[model samples]
Target: MDNKVPYSLPGMTESFLFHESQLIEVGLNNAQPEEVPPPAFVPPCISIDVSHLFTTDQIFPTRDDLINWVHGIAIENGYVVLITKSDSGGNGSRKAYVMLGCEKHGKYVPYRDPDLVEGTRTQKTECPFRLKGRPMKNGIDRDWRLKVMEGTHNHEPARSLIGHNFVGRLNSEEKEQVEKMSKSWVPPRKMLLTLKENNPLNLTTISQIYGACKRLRKSLRGSLTEMQHLLKKLDGDKYVHFERHEPGSEVIRDVFWAHPNAIKLFNTFPYVVIMDCTYKTNKYKIPLLEIVGLTSTDKTYSIAFCYIVNEGTDDYVWALECMKSLLADQAMLPKVIVTDRDLALLSAAKQSLPNTSHLLCLWHINKCVLAKCKLYVGTDDFAELVMGKWGEVVDAATVEEFEVQWMQLFNMCKDKYSNFTSYCSTTWLVHKEKFAKAWTNHVMHFGTTTSNRAEGAHASLKKMLRDCKGDLATSWDASHSLTCNQHTEILASFERSIHRIDHIFMFPFYTNIRGFVSNKCLQLIDDEHIRMKSYGGCDCLLRETHGLPCGCELAGHRSTTLLSINSICY
Candidate 1:
């Protein structure tokens, strides 16, 4: 045996250790031959030993023990086995359980039925299994089934309890009681023809009706609270009532509140309020406060109005207070207030609206000039000449130029009015700062620089009140109607004329011019001078036309020559 080979059994062969180098060589040509040995063979051997790390009872004596063991195994090896008891025979007894394999530590945990935990598996029964589906739906279905079963089984008893409680507790018959109450209650009248009449209820009418109602209530010994309650009910139902005695203020407030369109109209432009007063025949002068909005359309619209006391010694304070009330009510403070140069009015406006700029109407200035310059009427013709030819004077760039042109024209007056020139100049020219920067420019174009809007409004009110002939209440009604009607018509006309310059052109321009002339010349000049030069030519005509001097320069010209020549030529 070779040392390299291990010992073998008796059936082994020598060829097992044979190498190719040691193989017997046989040559066909030679007579000698060598045979190779067969490989060795060894018998298979087996060994058997039985020992347990833990007994079956120690590892899994109960189902919980088995489950815990399996859970441990599953955690370690990612696999598990389930053992369940089964019945071996027809007798109801536990037996050797069946073992089932499942994925260990899978995404889902298996749930076992408590009733079947210690019982044997049955072949005929459906196995409990959880599928991959919505857990909420499964829970809801189980609860609904339980509720349905309970509802069906207990329906009669629940209904009996409810009916007993409802009927046994009430003593009165509900339907009969309701019918009796309905028979006793009376329905109120649905309409009030006299109270709801179409005629508008103004302040005076409301006061009268309220007084009558009060008298009726007192005489009849009626409940005042009940009457008030009824009136309140009427107000609630949108029916007319006479409780609000002062309807004028209420109407004005409503008109302003109901239509913010008017406010929007004012806010659309730079606005200046022009206010004034006129005497109504009722022995009371009514101060009319107008909110005038200067539109981009180059037109002024009266957006709001109020009647204050007239601006006079007795009523100026009251009027101003009323104006302040109006402004406060409207929540408006204007940038500029343009009005006639009434001292009381100015003081009131200045004190109330401290931040606002006050402007004296240029129209008033012309009137003042005329009143102060009476003697200048015949000699200098300053008022008449300047009225027509002072476009350059108004357009003068500086105060110096204005004064120079003013004096040049003033000095040309006759000797009689020399003192008048000084007086007029001292009064009107002394206080140029009170007027607006645009005053002269505005007068140059529009002529009468006072807001004719106020005058027009006054005229309109007078016309409407004329029919009432100074009856205060009637006049108030008429004035109110006039304002509303005129504002409506004027706003409509303005809208219509906005695009129609032809219609605008049809309005008389000379009216404004004549107003300016009258305010400036006739009002300021004295009677004697006016009479002296009534038929005579104008005195201050520096620029002549057609040999006959202009009106002012030709005042003292014994122009019978020119008058006769013209007559003769004709």
Candidate 2:
């Protein structure tokens, strides 16, 4: 036991160990930890057509000009290619093209035994992909161009694509989440945050996430050649029309689409339809005009959707003509078409469907009021006063009453506020009949004073076409998804009508009108019944405005019967 000497040094006798004990303390105090080198940059194995990266300049414009060009292309395409090796000329220009490789590719790793394993990992660098370029002289200066592209990976290239870093490439799981989030209308930035929380492996840069989302979206929206193929894949129940601006090029300027339900709904409720344009719905920022109708039950139904290159009168006229052709029965003209205050749309509607009453939306008139007053006082007390007064004046029940009130309101406004009065007189008053409840009392507006149905449809479509970026094919994909959901909702309503009525008063009239009209109409009729009980006296305003029987009509002899009560406006 005494043979063992306790000392930091090994295999020394006791006397030798005692002599070195003082030196051992000094050596331990002077010892330092070994240094570690930083990890080397590795380029990703990415494939791109390198033709755009080349240049024929004699002198590399600047010292880093060539590097910047190649870097820009790689960054834009997503994935990083680090400058691994570089060569230089005497004049500080690139003599020959530099070499770069993916971070996961090339280089030798040190070997470690599993039994004696320390905290170290070896990344397999089998990918052989490389990008090559160099500067050349043309007697005057050095010119730089992409010389060669070499190598390929056994596996796929990258995910988070088109960025300055490798973090832009997405893996399989991240790609799935991206597509799901995109379909749900989650913005790309928001998707990145969500992906980071669930999957901490790949997501790093915004470009990476954007690239992943775009890849799936690009798949959803195929090439232009697939567009013609898409059109041919349609069922016979769909009505699709294509219009070209230039006959020689056959470039489509406008397109109109209508499903069988749309056409059928138009046939049933052709009295009042709304056409509102949704903008920035695709790459061209053209207007996506949604045409919708309201049933007797107040249920909104799709009629048609039109895409026009511009919001001009000619464009509107052509779209309307196409709509008429789709319906195929010019005699079945709509009683009115509610639209925002677009002079071009109104002009086109008048020209194309002269018989159809073109009504301006009251909501649009209200907006104009705000616009006028804001121009006058921004958002002060005067703006509120003018807005309030305008609402009252336009909502007047009778034409005679409205005229008198408008004069009083006008005189008061003119006497106190000249510019606001001028705006109303020169702009809104000239189109009084289009918006005033008095003039449009008998019009079958379905209780709507605006193109809210179209706006609502736009909002719904935006949910499908979230952020609204992409091309023609992408827009069509969004429309198809929304249309399918709409059909499902319509079917559910139909099923409910056939089986049972919920939370609605049941009169014999409900039984009579169940199969004929919508449940919305029956509910309205029930509401009218409740209102009828409270009526001391009545005017036929509800009948005129809503195309339904009023208390006054019900008070008459033939009450509560669909046919005898009051003929529907359509």
Candidate 3:
């Protein structure tokens, strides 16, 4: 019954006997069952016996000093220890002592309000961590000594103390840095980085920085409200500020302001101006109307900014009226006012400056048309074709040509894209005269047919602001700084226009107007001269649109030794 046999192998040093029972035992124990290692050696919640760090032999100069020393040790070990209780003992009834414990040491009691829909959460863990600081035995020098009461916590210590309200609070020096950096418009993140770079132990958070900034702004406001502070700052800074209040209330409806130099620039170059509304530049959620003008040296300058209650006709009228008030003379109103097709602003412009011609920004119209028609078309290829054709219609050089191009576009796309053609017919075709080059070319717009200038000014202003949630006073401060820098550049440009001339502009044809006109003007004349040589004729669009001589005029002027500066139009 044993069933045993003797076996031998070539590489074996000894022979062994095999049995059915032995083989079964070997199979059962094939690979020794993997050993389960014991769990990791976890240190206690309080890794080090920091109680040894707090010594009764050490005496602090004051009670606050003792508390600070203990708290600092707790913070280093990744926990916040705050004062739980303190006995001043002013009447000397008992010795003065302060109790400190973990910030998360209390028990949460349910305090639900019947009127409220939800209950709030709490972070209390009923931790039993505690320390005590009391006056020294002598009690004559006001010195204090520290003693550990409960050295253990019921919970694990934090791995890091960031975002802890107590740890995130800024100290006095850090608060001063934040206040200064905020006025300079340094972003909160940057402020945090700077603080950390100065002190690696700083645990300040962005929310805390924001809270500090809010408090600082509120304090700066003194007894005045946000709007009142804005008005006061504007007045103190000598800005030309105008505000319209509600009929029977003191609440402001619309407010406008312009710098003194801005008004002067407008009076100097009142030929072309552009207005547009930008959003998300303030906390009020109100639209900011940005008005800009062009200089003779081809620079864009911000003329004014308005915070309107709404983009309604009445609001726009008030803003435009404020703009009109900056004119040196009623006759000196801008000859051309470029804006997007905001119907309210368009009508307001007409009412405020009746003599000024209002033209729609062609770029905005084209952008809108492309975005809308692309959605209607099925494929990207067809969408591109539609835009190409639309561009032709927009760029038609004459009224007759514009009509012809439009007809071609409709016939090509009408059957399959009826929605596209209908939208064009109703929305854009009715306002063709405002944006189409065929009509816009007839006006002296000085080649500015879009509101890109105002867009650029907005981009620059917002870059300086950095944050959209700034108050009106902060926005005005940024704008004031921008205006000062812009005026400096403009002055330097004027000086160059009078003193500097390019080598290409030394020809006799530019002799008389070379120094009197801007280098930009001479460059335009030079360009025209080249065009006359390249092309045999010119359409004279420049002569009509910008009041500058075209290539054809340049050819006739070749007979004259010198051209007069009067030939160049402002």
Candidate 4:
């Protein structure tokens, strides 16, 4: 009889290892190997010796000082010392002692709880390193003495303790230093460097600085919630604050604030106002609407800020109304408001400031035009060519020139890039008067063409506010400090314009306005003079738009100054 097994099982034919069995039966085997367990962790052989540092003769001024000194030595020797137990008495009835041990001294006891998830696994190995501290009397001085209980550890010394939670905490003094620097808006990395410089043994990390700051904020808030504390601080600071809640409910919908100095600056230079919204400035993810004003020296000042729950038209109208409340006199209302192509903002501006001229930001319009055209074209050269023609359309000096240039642009792109041409016609061409030089040059925009001033102000504010996860009160503090610094610079500029005159302006035509007009205005006049001298007479657009003498107006003679400080309008 043949004792050979069948090639496969009847039902489990696909599962049978026919080839393997055949090889095994014929002794041509490459059989399966036995399973092996994973390798166990082997502690490093090199151990740190810290027993000599702890002695009964080395007494500390207090228990805290003793613990701190012991921990410092342990950390220096590549290990951490933790307080395992302590005892205290109201009277001198019981002796006070503190049991110190290695961070990995004892085994972790797992708490069995069905409701709570299991804690993360630990590296505890019942380390044998231990020390003890007790109150000692030294010549009428109450001090503490340290004694070594066990000198050796079961595990290897730590190579670095940079992230150890207990080891990287900031002491009381360090925390105070961090608070002072944080109030100055210093970054976390710089805070860490300062700490390290102050104490070479400090293992504090940047994350620890952040935690301490968070705790400080929490403590400052006390019993109040973030919003309540914010309102309290705003009221305390005498800020012009406004808040709105959902109709028929207590949920807050929006908040607005303006510093007193900012209000004064707005009242002083309220001719041209620029408004825009920035995002990711607070924990609520609300949109922050910024209103910026231009000074006589061309410096941009933040007028107000609003945290709105939504970017809807009604929200913008409410914010605008809050700004309108700042105007003590109706005649001081802004004559021109510059903004991007946000239809909601545009409608709000029209509804809120009916008499104010709403002008579109030319920079934003050009950016949009370039971005949309880039999507249709394959090459940058072609895109730039289209932008060049588009520039001609916007820069035309007259309505006739604008019409002719617009026709040229339409004809050039109508055949090759229809999508871009159509986008411009539908989206931008309708709003030409707001951004085109032909119409904008006739309006008194103070020679402002874009919302770049507002954009720059946003940049500065965000830079001061390095993190977006801050609370409302934190945001307010940062902006308040920024406004104070801005006012200081503005006042300095005003002083310079009043008293100091640069040698560059030491010209016969600039004699009368030397110490009265701004350096920016003098520069403008000087540029116009150079242009008139180089290229002959041109359209006096500056006089009509900016209220300043143009190259054509200054082309006559150079006997004396042609303009006074009051003649130059903002």
- Residue-by-residue lDDT tens digits, candidate 1, 117-219: 3545221111221111111122121111000001011001122222222111222342233233222321111111233242222112333333343343344
What TM-score should be assigned to candidate 1?
0.36
| Backbone clash numbers for all candidates listed | 16, 26, 0, 0
Instruction: Indicate the residue-level lDDT of 178 in model 2.
Output: 80
Instruction: Report the lDDT tens digits of candidate 3 across residue range 250-328.
Output: 8998889999999999988888889999987888788888999988788899999998877999898888888888987
- What's the ranking of the predictions by lDDT, best on top? 4, 3, 2, 1
TM-scores for all predictions: 0.36, 0.65, 0.80, 0.87
Deviating ranges (above 4 Å) for candidate 1: 1-270, 281-294, 298-300, 303-332, 371-376, 379-395, 409-416, 435-448, 490-570
Model 3 CA lDDT for position 483: 85
Global lDDT of each candidate: 0.39, 0.68, 0.82, 0.83
Backbone-clash count (model 4): 0
Which 10 consecutive positions of candidate 3 have the poorest summed lDDT?
Answer: 559-568
Candidate 1 vs candidate 3, lDDT winner: 3
How displaced is residue 306 in candidate 3, in Å?
A: 1.6
Q: Which candidate achieves the best TM-score against the true structure?
A: 4
Error of 1 at 160 (Å): 99
Question: Candidate 2: TM-score?
Answer: 0.65
